[model samples]
Target: MRIFVWLFRAFIFFALFAFALNNSQEATVRWFFGHEWRAPMVIIVLLAFGCGAALGVLAMVPAWWKHRRVAQRGGDIAPAVSDAPTPTEVQTPSGVRDGL
Candidate 1:
């Protein structure tokens, strides 16, 4: 299993390596007011992917901080409560069910 996993990882690496080699051609990115940026296609793609990932993480920062603050305040997620009485034990086709 480990060998297979390693092989799969290697395959992925080589695939990406081939992609980069194939995309070695230069690319131009146009910006506002006749501004232009240029780089190898692979580098441009990598930069775009990296920036997207970074922006995604940055967008989640507020929610992450809020959850962290709640955790620090000991705000645990309690189980839902019900007014009706629940059975202590019940029989099922597989096995006995005791809510566990």
Candidate 2:
């Protein structure tokens, strides 16, 4: 399964590589802030993908750091729940008897 996944990834990488190589038309991208940047269409696509990935990782950093800190502190901050019930004497219900 792992080998199949790796092969699939490799195939996709090569396919994208070939596509970028074949399509190298220069294009200009207009930013929302009135800035225009020119680059190959493939470069722009790859840059947008890279920026999205970077932003995703950046957004996760704070949560990851908090989890790491909690884990490093021996996980003492988490609440503990007991699975066992409290010790109490059981009483037979009315109209129920033993050896019936």
Candidate 3:
């Protein structure tokens, strides 16, 4: 399984490499104040993808911090669940029938 995963990753890497090579044309990015930046199309796309990934990680920072804090305090990180309750042991609230 690990070998297959590695092979898959290598295949994807080569595919992306070939795509980048084929799309080496210069592309322009216009900014405010009539400014423009130019770079290879592949480079621009890769940069945008990287920036988006970074931003996505940044967006999760607060949730990660909350989890870290809970873990540091040794609080209940998981919701309550006992091993496995038998049908008879599981309780049903009033006005609800167990259909026994």
Q: Which candidate wins on lDDT?
A: 3
- Tens digits of per-residue lDDT for model 1, 5-97: 999999999999999999999999999999999999999999999999999999999988988998899986555676665665534567666
Each model's lDDT: 0.91, 0.90, 0.95
- Per-residue C-alpha lDDT of model 3 across residues 29-90, encoded as one tens digit per residue: 99999999999999999999999999999999999999999999999778888779888898
The numbered model that scores best in TM-score is 3
Q: Indicate whether candidate 2 or candidate 3 has the larger lDDT.
A: 3
Q: Is candidate 1 or candidate 3 better by lDDT?
A: 3
Off by over 4 Å in 2: 1-3, 32-34, 76-100
List TM-scores for all candidates, in order: 0.73, 0.65, 0.74
> For residues 1-100, could you state the per-residue lDDT of candidate 2 as single tens digits?
9999999999999999999998799999988989999999999999889999999999999989988999898786567986666556566799999799
Question: Residue 54 of candidate 3: its Cα lDDT?
Answer: 100
